[model samples]
Target: MNQLSTNWVLGHKVTPYQTTGNYNLVKGESPAGAQGPPPHIHKKYEEVFFILQGQMEFVLDGRQSTVTAGELVNIPSGCLHTFSNTSDESCLWLNIHSPKGFQSFFDAFGVPESEKDAMQQSLAAERITDVLKRAREFDMEIKIP
Candidate 1:
């Protein structure tokens, strides 16, 4: 069994997280209408997402696809991608990125769910700005669209 963290990032609970040479894995739950990061490309990492519950809308490259439970999305290195929980209920999923490193990006922004006003702090203007500014350092090239 994997250990889950109590931290939340961008309103999602992500855990069973770990960084390794081959890949990194994280399980997450996204609330209805919640979105992931801005469209971005990882210069070297390849990512895959397996939806476990509800569904999410993903924008890969410039095309949109709705991925549902029991479905998976494959993203290659340098592909511009982003996703959102567009369904009426929350979505659960597992994500893996090969050649691990991006977990630090979440570490820099994730907040403990038990903290008072955790959500507010996680989405503060300054923090969002900081995320945008430092994202490239994490190999994520944000695409404004």
Candidate 2:
């Protein structure tokens, strides 16, 4: 219901929008070499991703796939997955999760992009640990390692 703001979340710039009980949407930009969240599953939500620029590498159910601009990936609920911007340049993408709630995770842990050193803080060990601790509250079963 409120306007979404952008935040630096785990080495990426994320803007969560269109959040509702039905679904949550986000636009993101990841710098080269940015490794996304660890492999995880959402037992109650299906996820989709649309790549807008550059390329991204994704692991879905143990199968690795390279998605490029204009490509899309659909991950069913309970699938094991993770992603990384493995290209030599930054990549832009959009994501959506059905049966909304995951947006709360980003909102709670993401550093306001407007902060002077948001990028640095977003990846800090302590901040990551805190985020990881509460991940399950948002339906995330993160695989730490």
Candidate 3:
């Protein structure tokens, strides 16, 4: 069988490419004080976050909730959502987006294998208008917080 090790995939100090999917699979791990993206919505893609370890805070539609290990959250398309680690330890989780295509989205907004560190920082700091424009180009709607 083909074994795709973690080292074989693209990653950053904050994240690791444990796996990807024909659909979308989030093999996410975060240290204490870590947080994911700001509140945003993908009008065309559904997402799910499965908490595997530690505790996290999930904010959706302005409501906040804490999720612990073994819990899974399903986010419908077009709903704004975000997550953060509030515990003192590292948190591990999976964030899966359905129907793929988010890889391109992620690459455009943050560090991908093809970009330099500075460029990645620029991508991460991208203006909301630019992000929205890219979203529009991708036929996805992104709502800023």
lDDT of 2: 0.91
Give the runs in model 3 whose Cα sits over 4 Å from its true position. Answer: 1-22, 109-142
Put the candidates in TM-score order, highest first: 2, 1, 3
Highest lDDT: which candidate? 2
Model 1 RMSD in Å is: 1.6
TM-score (all chains, Cα) for each model: 0.92, 0.93, 0.68
Higher lDDT: candidate 2 or 3?
A: 2
Best by TM-score: 2
lDDT of each: 0.85, 0.91, 0.62
- lDDT by residue (tens digit), candidate 2, 1-145: 5558899998999998775468898999999999989899899989999999999999998999999999999999999899999888999999999887788889888999999999989999998898789888988899865
Position 72, candidate 1: lDDT: 98
Candidate 3: tens digits of C-alpha lDDT, residues 1-145: 2222221011222232434455555466666776555577777888888888887899888889999999988889888887778779887877777777775555454443344553334334344446656666654655565
